[model samples]
Target: MRDIKIIWDFRGPAALKTAEHHAIHLKEYAANCAIEYTTIDIQTFNEFYTIAFIVVKEKDMLSVRDALKPHRAEVYIKKRRD
Candidate 1:
């Protein structure tokens, strides 16, 4: 029952803002489509690169991936608060 991270990458000066906005749409899509997700977030690498990602259970990956057509994906590892 592992989780999967689906990621969409953005580049250029507007990358950060674009990634953030994409995360918003990811949330809306999950809500409207009744898609289960652990979280949706944007990661800033720098002014030139950013990514929007949605984490969902492995079982839900295919459906979400097909619908979203993200740039890439990987196994999701939850970070400990500590």
Candidate 2:
């Protein structure tokens, strides 16, 4: 199994409510997929993007990525190296 880092960028006003909304939605998404996920803030020129670190079994990579397609507009994936 390999660890993967999934980054989701939310574009909009950089308000507290916006950030909270992203966190809440992501939390639900992760829980539903049963994937271990953690989130952090990434600074950007216009808005703040949320970067989620998801650790999943290598064999389940495609499945998990597909399941998260709803957020593709702001999502990205990468493998973690030791």
Sliding window of 10 residues with minimal summed lDDT for model 2: 70-79
Point to the candidate with the largest lDDT: 1
Candidate 2 Cα errors over 4 Å, as ranges: 15-19, 37-53, 70-82
Tens digit per residue, CA lDDT, model 2, 1-82:
4444444555556544565565566677667767664343333444444333344455555676676653432333554898
| Inter-residue clash pairs, candidate 1 | none
Q: How would you encode candidate 1's per-residue C-alpha lDDT over 1-82 as one tens digit per residue?
A: 9999999999999999999899999999999999899999999888899999999999999999899899999999988998
Note the Cα lDDT for every prediction shown: 0.94, 0.51
For each candidate, what TM-score against the reference? 0.95, 0.46
Global local distance difference test of model 2: 0.51
In angstroms, give how far residue 53 of model 1 lies from its true place.
0.4
RMSD (Cα, Å) for all candidates, in order, is 0.8, 5.3
